[model samples]
Target: MPQLQAAVKELQEKGIALPDYPDEPGTDAERDARARYDKVKGSAVNPVLREGNSDRRAPASVKNYARNHPQLMGAWTPESKTTVATMGAHDFRSRQKSVVLPADDVLTIKHVAADGTGTVLKDGLKVLQGEVVDGTFMSAAALEAFLAEQVARAKAEDVLFSVHLKATMMKVSDPIIFGHVVRAFFADVYTAYGEQLLAAGLDGTNGIAAVLAGLDGLEDGAAIKAAFDQALADGPRLAMVNSDKGITNLHVPSDVIVDASMPAMIRTSGHIVGTRR
Candidate 1:
């Protein structure tokens, strides 16, 4: 994390003024003189409370000031505890109205690799084994194209490809439009991949459905394992769960020989996208 002092210093170096300090003494008379001067000047002389203040004041300071000087900061404003409480209640109600469930009838896929060691092939192939037998190298586009075809085939076989949205730096919202945007974006991706799969004669029985349920009911580990199990049972496993940018692989028993190619499909099929938040 960047240090607050460094940020402040940078701002100062950039000629940005710090927030005015209304609490700082301006005159010996203090309250009376300050109030009189404010009335006469029609502005606060204190740098912290002055009009057109441009200082990047921290929230903590504002909160502290409100806490210590409720009489000064209007009680009806958001800074007041009573107002904040009211806003909180109102926000809760608003969220209840705006809350959206996950997409509809979606089944998630969890990919487990050899010892959970999986690599993400964004636009390239990761050769986990022998060198290019013919010294042939596959480009990122080629690899992505290959994986996209496989995902499409899976989708055709009533299996939906997990569509993911890269929402790093996305702001949280009670009524989120980004969800719709994500759905639309991934729909396009699946469509394109589906077309490629068809061209490659790999399109199979796959079904795409919206994710409608929450994972709150299951334990953490159970939920993770359940995703993998469902992928095995379901023909076209689709998971939209968030993943770190890196790839992971899990080694399971030899008897649990899932498809060797399935992990690659899951990693590239939009299941591994992440966000900053």
Candidate 2:
């Protein structure tokens, strides 16, 4: 704990502020702050401290692979193609409202100082705080409607239907979109195990593996498994991450990164591209 404190202090000296580590998290906000602190405690700080930034350029090997294994790059051609794209950049913001704080008022994280004062984490600040909207804005229903249209268009023109998502930096919201993709792809699995899933505190936003992982001792596990199998058999043609392991784009969060995935489609050719990058 002393080492962590010293490191955080050093970062603060360098103007690389880390979230305040709560001594005792009391309220819901404090508890959430503590949970976030726990996650970044050992893992996240070093990256920022050492590099001063999170975004890293691609490794040499990755560039080599892109050159050597061109087919892995997707069927990108420079001519005769049009595509529909979904950009997630700022689409998932819910209850969009702006708040302008007076200059005398400061915005601090939820943690309070020993004197019970909220320290000024940021001064002269402006914030537009909003909850991430689930379902209505971006959910399985949304993915289905999109895929239904794209799949129809792709089949009509005999082209590949592809999707783009960014589960990298957008972190929280993109994972939810990824979950929607999973539920849309495996509609039956979700329909069958939904109640059990919600009861187990699992949702499509966490991915289908989470739902399956929570099926510990359920009576309908086998039935859900069968339905999942059938959904795979009948679902629309999905972009594959790994054909050998059957890793579809929706199987993992970072598989279909928008920056990487969308360009690949545009280069190869395009049908209807959708993303919230």
TM per candidate? 0.19, 0.54
What is the RMSD, in Å, between candidate 1 and the native fold over all Cα? 26.6
Q: Candidate 1 on 56-136: residue-level lDDT in tens?
A: 566998889878876422123333211001122223233343223333222222334659975543322222122221211
* Cα distance off (Å), candidate 1, residue 32: 36
Worst 10 contiguous positions by lDDT, candidate 2 = 126-135
1-277 in candidate 2: lDDT tens per residue?
Answer: 3334555677889999655667798888788888987665444434543454755788899999978887643455576445665634334444244444333232443446569987654454322223221232334455567655665664466444455766666576677766665665665666767787666666666665666666666778778767777775565555666666666566667777788766666564553243211
- Candidate 1 off by > 4 Å: 3-5, 13-15, 18-143, 168-277
Clashes of each: 32, 9
Single out the weakest 10-residue window by summed lDDT for candidate 1. 247-256
Please give the lDDT score at residue 17 for candidate 1: 63
Q: What is the C-alpha RMSD of each candidate to the true structure, in Å?
A: 26.6, 10.9
* lDDT for each candidate structure: 0.34, 0.59
Residue 272, model 1: Cα distance from true site in angstroms: 17
